[model samples]
Target: MPWAHAGYADADALAWFAHCEQVRADGSGHEFGIFDAASGTLVGGCGLNQFNTVNGFYNLGYWVRESWQRRGAASAAVQALSRFAFDELRLGRVEIVVAEDNAPSLAVAERAGALRECLARNRLKLNGRFANAFVLSLVPGAPNTIGGPLSPNTALT
Candidate 1:
């Protein structure tokens, strides 16, 4: 809900999928759909993007449907995606940036063991406006506070 608006259409979805595939093919990033394990419903999405390969890091982002809020969907996606970013891609850092006022996402970052690094100015462009954001990082070799490191194939609840 936070990342999307009400006017999304079928054409928009098609373009989005094409973009995701292109990103994967080009090695720029990987995006994944978060599905509910029990019923196979899409609950959210998470991805590792904005790669800084030279620095061994990627920017991680996620969003959950309003109906699925507080149900562990985003947390599970974060852990899974971070695992992939670190283990499969051999990246050293995963950065999660959240708008200063986005409490739910901020909580998800904290709950997933990301260390708060700083508050960055004009860090994000939300709905045509710039806003401050909290920068957090999840690094390998640190203790995972939520679920342990999960495989990318693992089903999210």
Candidate 2:
């Protein structure tokens, strides 16, 4: 996650993999390797994690590699994940915390119709100093579920 997001850690990585295993074992957490449907090459990645089954809340996060930023890859992946979250997982809410400066990422979240809720100032401790972050979400409504295979997709926007 550090390579894709930021920061690095020892136990965090281990714990994360372990979490992935646990979630996958029960058929919950998902890690999707993004690919170019045209070229069949692994272009990047996307998935939903930190899932909370009982409360029906989880996190949505992903990276599309530096090379595959535009092209609507992130939007496609997020739409798929969000559909899974709402349709399959039956989740009511999904949240995404994005670094404020990451316009590409923010754009991805926005394109997915996630609302910007707040400016979390000095909220994330990245390198000893707190970094500002944007709290965005897919809370059952917005516009632009415009590009994916989401069932009743038109009803959303």
Candidate 3:
């Protein structure tokens, strides 16, 4: 995942958790681990990372494990996060920026009802290289079933 820290060690992951705690404490963002409901196994993680308070929007991010790929876990995680951002945080929009060559992620965004807003050039720097990306967005009050109208309490497990 280009969006994620490359070659993250255990300490790096721990530091990330601490950062997430600080972000929550400072009211900057929210991050959560995605787990399988039935077995309670960690499948991935999803979060509202970058907050654009001026625009009332957030940058959404998620990644599923290789074993969980092709399943609906990514989509579900995104939907739950989107619901959290829109309903709980009361944010205006959630954006998913994906590399153009990443077909699976693009599909996930599309399946989550994100509208492709535009193509941004050299928008992402991954592994010391710049890459183009498609900016997909989901706005509140949009007529979409990606994140079904579940009660706030039911969105995340």
RMSD of each: 2.8, 6.1, 3.3
Candidate 2 lDDT by residue in tens digits, 53-132: 67768888877667766776777777878887877877778888888787888988987788888989975677566789
In candidate 1, what residue range of length 10 has the lowest lDDT sum? 145-154
- What Cα-based lDDT does every candidate model obtain? 0.83, 0.72, 0.81
What are the runs in model 3 whose C-alpha is more than 4 Å off? 2-9, 149-157
Worst 10 residues of 2 by lDDT: 148-157
List model 1 lDDT by residue over 1-157, tens digit each.
Answer: 4337788888988898899999999888898888876678888778889988688688999988888888777888888888788779988788999999999899989988888999999999988899999999988887743347553433643
Q: What is the TM-score of each predicted model, taking all chains together?
A: 0.89, 0.74, 0.87
For candidate 3, give the lDDT of residue 130: 94
Q: Which sequence of candidate numbers ranks them by lDDT, best first?
A: 1, 3, 2
- Residue 24 error, candidate 3, Å: 1.1
Mark the regions of model 2 whose C-alpha exceeds 4 Å error after superposition. 4-19, 26-28, 127-129, 141-147, 150-157
Stretches of model 1 off by over 4 angstroms after superposition: 1-3, 144-157
Global Cα lDDT for candidate 3: 0.81
